[model samples]
Target: MTTETRPPAAPPRVDTSRRTRAPLHLGWWLAAAVIGLTLLNIGSVVVRSPNLDWSVVWEYFLSTDVLAGLARTVELTAIAMACGIVGGVILAVMRLSPVPVVSWAAKSYVWFFRGTPLLVHILFWYNLAALVPAIAVEIPFGPTLFEVDTNDLITPLLAAVIALGLNEAAYMAEVVRGGLLSVDPGQTEAAKALGMTHRQTLRRVVVPQALRVVIPPTGNQVISMLKASALVSVTSTPELLYSVQVIYNNNFKTIPLLVVASAWYLIVTSVLYVVQHHLERRFSRGTGRG
Candidate 1:
């Protein structure tokens, strides 16, 4: 057999040189064309629009009043978000409580706040003094500890924060509850088996894990809160949009001031977008491929 061995069997051919065309995707081509046209339209508008006063926008973009208003916006967003996060966590805990009354109260809270329009909430909070002129800390049928005038407490800034924070708490509660539900029940059981108390398990084990699921929506809510803070302008709160309104009211430069406000909002939201993306990637670690 060795003496009669033929030349090595010919290698199978792959024909690497011959190129095959990729299958055409009409949907992809249509999407590309649409996007291209949209970009072209935006370019044309930026280049050729009749009445975009770039000079005025540039001049007033960093003016003192606008800066002050922007600062106020940031302050309101931070305070409101802090309040929302704390309150929401409590509400979420209440919703998940073993007691029926606690669960009912939490559900009722979410139902009422989520059912109402945010604008209405804002107006209601801004005008709350009209209904109750004073808020007090007092024992029922006993002496008052302290009292404060509602008007003194509800400054424009405070009103905006209160409205946004309280309203945001309802939504945050649902987000937190959903996140909590996503965690495995077996983990809770295991914690209990390990002799962990309910509060200890929740604080040390549950909430930490739940936060990964909750963060993305929380970021979105933060962005929404940032924009919603502008609605305070209706109450003349002197945030970014209100600052622009003040300028336009004085100089009759409506469009430019709006553009300045728009620019600032776009800038802030873009930064937040980047921050959210990195945070999500961080939290997703060990949960995905190498």
Candidate 2:
């Protein structure tokens, strides 16, 4: 039809000024509320319990014996880690050697140490006198050069150190090997292209870079070693847990003494965490994670 047609009137506009709201996340809120209440209840109970004896905890928290034990624990951690680092480096290099016998020897060492229980290792070292009776330095086909009774040579403290250190070495060898492996092959080739020898490339290029990957785990190992020092108490080497045990045995205030030990552990571990954080940050520089 020729009749003028006006566009159909626009449909009546719907009001969208009031948009639908999102759900309130009631389930998550409820769960958080329940968790908060549970934690609060537990805290209240722990704080108010008559059996806890907070005063006794404070009494022995920094006693001389406990302090000495803490020092021994730190000493063990330091010595064991030093031994582990040196031994681990040697084993890692041997494991990566071109000679099959060398590699196999390293592998065997790691396998034997890692597979056995550390407790047994500690006990074995402590009782080494029973097995070998004596330690001697001798010429294979000639006269003995030196001899010392095993018991005399391996005192309880020495036994603990040797056991902990050797055990730690097996684990550290794997750690060091993994770190070395993390370095790019291209970097080694580049170092060789610049006329670097194998040792030179490792010492100058590979190790420095590998430290970035190696340090964090090494720090963790130190913390673990600190805690593990407690096991040395079996050898009657006084460390943190053992010191606490001696006190509780005499006074029979077991829980409070245990609390003291636990408190010290928490404090020390917290300090280690801080140190580890700083070390990680120092090494992680230039990497975005830093």
Top candidate by TM-score: 2
Please report how far candidate 2 places residue 233 from its true position, in Å: 1.1
Instruction: Give the lDDT of residue 281 in candidate 2.
Output: 88
Candidate 2's residue-wise lDDT over 1-290, tens digit each?
59998999999999899899887798989999999999999999879988889999889998999999999988998999999999998999899999999999999999999999999999999999999998999999999999999999999899999999999999999999999999999999999999999999989989888998888899899889888888999887888999999999999999888888888888888999999999888878888887
Q: Which pairs of residues collide in candidate 1?
A: none
Which candidate comes out best when scored by lDDT? 2
- In model 2, the clashing pairs are none
Alpha carbon lDDT of each predicted model: 0.90, 0.92
| Per-model TM against the reference | 0.86, 0.87
Model 1 alpha-carbon miss at residue 169, Å = 0.5
Worst 10 residues of 1 by lDDT: 281-290
> Where does candidate 2 stray beyond 4 Å?
1-27
